[model samples]
Target: MVKLLFLLVAISFVLLFSLTDFSGESPKHGESMMSVHLPDFRLIPTTGASGPESFVFDISGDGPYTGLSDGRIVKWLANDSRWIDFAVTTSTREGCEGPHEHQRTEHVCGRPLGLAFDKSTGDLYIADAYMGLLKVGPEGGLATRELDEPLRFTNSLDIDPRTGVVYFTDSSSVYQRRNYIGAMMSGDKTGRLMKYDPNTKQVTTLLSNLAFANGVVLSQNGDYILVVETATCRILRYWLNDTSSTTTPESRGNYEFFAERLPGFPDNIKRSPRGGYWVGLNTKHSKLTKFAMSNAWLGRAALGLPVDWMKVHSYWVKYKGNGMAVRLSEGSGVISEVFEGKNGNKWMSISEVEEKDATLWVGSVNTPFAGMYKI
Candidate 1:
């Protein structure tokens, strides 16, 4: 009986040690699997027949803020708070055909992608995929194109207040926004990150041949720039001070992969005034989805089928591939916390503005509820 008891004890010790080792060193190859219970959040109920695509607080103005949706931009006042169309997009509507027919509003044809307010000039810098970069000033506004060449598919935009230099991403050189799915399915790395100097009127390519470069953000100190390579599931860093990095004309600076092996496809990223940057995850990466995406032939064949059939197939794939978010803190390689957004559907781009206290006014491209929360 003593010998039998000794053997059982020994077996238990070995199992315990093995379990501890595995749990300690387990790598998060796909989803973080670490679930987070966020604070109770609700949609700040938007009315008046508008589907706001993006929201930003006007720093220059007081009380009310601005939201860009569909074909119109609306002003939302906090006091006597009501949303009204401040500026309706009534620009040229010629090339707005086919899939982008919705963009051709009776007022505006081009869709606004990214927006930044120029500190020194008080002008709003807009990056429209079809219209390139534009400057819209106050007084119910007029827009003037800053760059002559229209972008292939311009995305996120940010301007450095100190240097007056603007940075933006052209998602794909070969594939436009209408065919965005085609570009992603093909895993085409034709995306480019660019810099435009307002002073010199010179545009330079920072990084090229990126796999769907989506978001661009300057570091807090303006030392390094972070650009997201969406399909590759990584963020690349470009050093502004390192001139001896590379001689290639397409080189922006000495770039290194900042963060990699994200759980899902990264859409947009924004720097928080408090600290850490928030990344918006569109869809979960699943093995089945990866299988479909792995082979070009399979992806093409699937896409060639009827739209409903393709969607039903994708629906099952998405069930496996889902929720993820990462917080990158102060240029450090370490990601602080990972948050899962929604249970079923993915949460696309996240646009945040500062409100009272340190609360973040959050908005999503696809989320049904848009509200504020403390991280």
Candidate 2:
């Protein structure tokens, strides 16, 4: 009887250990403890729209053009201190008036996530989550679709200033913008990094099988392009010279690992005028989220549970108000400095950080207003 009872207790322990998802130890927040001073941020409210996911400036440097939730790309008029609608990705503008329309009708109205410019021709390139890659001339209105192939979730992009070639990310081939959270929770690995050439009007897939590829930026010398994989918390550098090859785990020799195990899930990366790159940490990494993601059974079980319940148990809910951003050295990919929000008024869900004239222009996907901080 004693032996039987001991066997039963051991089986129970094994079952509990297998079924329960205990939180993993949290990683260090930033790369180093050397503190960097961050100035207080001031908000620049968008007139009627929200969620300026990315930004780019024209050759004249007249504006920081940003894409909003209401399916319009607006430019900040520093002269008038107001946002003016510069372009629209979709022609269907009737039902896309309100800000909340993106939640329900983003596919029909088009949600433009990334914005870039062909400095040589004054053509603005946009990555619309629903409409694929597009471009509008200097006289902006209804932007014309450039890429014919379908994309699941086009997120962010950057253009090579010299060649006018564009590089961008398709966040997930399985999930659209509305189901982005589902893709993240399920650990989808179908993201892609692609390039578009203006001269030939061709689209080429550079890399595939990525874990939520989010951002792309060309090196100053145009030798390599840096791409961010958000779910894996790493940055990948693809060689522009090796255009004929496709990158994968097996073909790892073709590309280089730029950065790994970042402090947070990185979103958009922009070239800083002062040199190096500014990376936006949408949110800090949570130990609980990591534990849940580490286990395949726990991740699958999460799909059956209520989304609100799962969110409450996740790290994002627990650390709702905090935000972080980092600056990395260009060639070494070293974390040179870290910027963080103090107190409960955290920057929260930073989508992009555009650096200009020693000021950081911060945008958020969840917030209604964009912010500017003087460095």
Candidate 3:
């Protein structure tokens, strides 16, 4: 009994000491932790109205763009903050229910992850984790599924105006969004980067075997597609029009690494209207924690322990810096420093946030207030 007591004390001391070293390393260049301040937008329930997940600004200089959890899309008037439901992601009428099916019923809403405006069609393309890739009319009406069997775990989507093609990523082909942590614990590469042709109605795999493919975007020139490998703290580029590279075999697709190592695991990537790309880091990268997460054997063992037992040995990771946006083209894609969470600033789970016109609206997974920001 005395030996067990001494062992517990020793373990606790070591664990506490280790946590002291787990501070945020550094903010990306030219970035500082700022408080987020947002407007007070009344939270409207989805049963009677649309459940907005994020917000975007109108490209035509009209107003704010809001995305809903029930799969409905809306346009918000910034002057008054009044919202009008424009499109619904799913027509189930039953709404989103259960882990397997996430469609909208009268009472619930389907999960709509990412939203983007296409310059060519002037329409909205959304990536629904369960329902696949969807497009809403310019006027924001009913949503139509473009790809039937979109890779599971579809998170973000971006369009190249030049090629008229859409690019997106699946975080894990083997796991649903709810089970991604388990997928990472398995150390399996089920993630993939995919492209869809609007004309042919065909979706092709551009890259595969990613650790956790998360966000995707097109270069300013539309020459390459950049995707985020979240679990691995890396970003990959798929060349669209490059003629010089023969490093990749035909079977594996002609994609090559555009950028490999990022400061953190990027979530949703967006091309800034001003310049550069904005990437949301799921969580601040921790060298010690990541080393353990990367080892499936060790992770499984730790996770298998009892809840209380695990708690005794567990370490809590608080992300000092919530997330940030970066410019890859300039200076070989130097990312901005981490954006701290505060008033008027953006928060995590930004894929759920909407960006239209100049306002950036985001809904939180576990936050006191949902976001309504002017970018």
Candidate 4:
């Protein structure tokens, strides 16, 4: 009886430790700010929507535009204390305009995941899961689809203001937005990073055979691009030399690992206000989660289990802090971190962390409100 009790205690520790961030020594207090300093933040509800997937600010910096789960782009009017609808991804609205999940009406009503803006033109670009790339002018109403080809799982995007070029990612060819869990678990590698040229109205594939390409962003000066590979828990960098977007022998060589062996599964990455980049971790690294993700056969077999795959998958991946956020330097070194254990209920499944004016705008993929944390 005594040995059994001891064994149970050991198991509990393993479960807890796996839910923490990637393996690394904590940075010095001067080099980085630890999350212990982060307290409860102010909440901004989504009104009738949920899942503020990603956030962006326009050229004038007057708005923090975000895409919603129910297929609408909303802008937060701080002074008015309200969220107003600015755009929608799909013109067909038979079952849209209400709260819903992606598994049910994403294909019909459309689901916008990534949002970006062309600072010069004041045009908002959206990466919709079902409808591909979309755009709305400064006025903002019903966003129009702007892609010649279809992108099944348009995850995230970033724009180059200098050239007005749009760079985005398609999570997987086999799985659309509705079944992203299967894509991540089965280790699908058909994901891609591509760019769209507004001048020519053509899309070019930059890199292929990726393990779940999630968040994306350009350098502070638009010199290179950084992409998050979720399944592998690393960031990949592609240097830009010219306007060439197609894949070539030399171009492929330019793609290299910017950061690797991340402790948590990185979801979205945005440029920090001070310097470096802020990467949001959707889930901490757990033993069960790592084992299942590493073994393709095991992951596929688990899908056949009698239980609900989504729920089962969620059980395998646990969050220790309720949420984890990290800021990386220009050289991909860990600078500071935040663990939302104190108020994990306020946010989880973090998808975007936008820093502005000494505050971190925290958005989650499964939460209905955004949390504002002071830096």
The residue pairs found clashing in candidate 4 are 22-263
Which consecutive 10 residues in model 2 have the weakest lDDT in total?
Answer: 18-27
**Cα deviation in Å at residue 293, candidate 2?**
3.4
Error of 2 at 13 (Å): 21
- Give the worst 10-residue stretch by lDDT in candidate 4: 339-348
Off-target runs (Cα >4 Å) in candidate 2 are 1-39, 99-101, 242-251, 306-321
Q: Give the TM-score of candidate 4.
A: 0.86
lDDT per residue for candidate 1 within 85-113, as digits (tens), equals: 55533455354333332523422465566
lDDT score of residue 181 within candidate 3: 58
TM-scores of the candidates are 0.74, 0.85, 0.73, 0.86
Residue 374 alpha-carbon offset, candidate 2, angstroms: 0.9
Q: Give the alpha-carbon lDDT of every model.
A: 0.60, 0.78, 0.59, 0.77
Instruction: Quote the positional error of residue 375 for candidate 4 in Å.
Output: 1.7
Ranking by lDDT: 2, 4, 1, 3
Q: For candidate 3, write residues 1-375 as lDDT tens digits.
A: 755655564464356436634333465556544345534333433333333444455457564565554455666565765666677777764534323223223223445666777777788888776777888878876688887684577777787777678888777877775455556556668888888889898888888888888778777787777787777666676777666345654313456555555655566666666566666554455554456555656544443433332233222322332443334443256654234354434343333434445644454332323455454
Between candidates 2 and 4, the one scoring higher on lDDT is 2
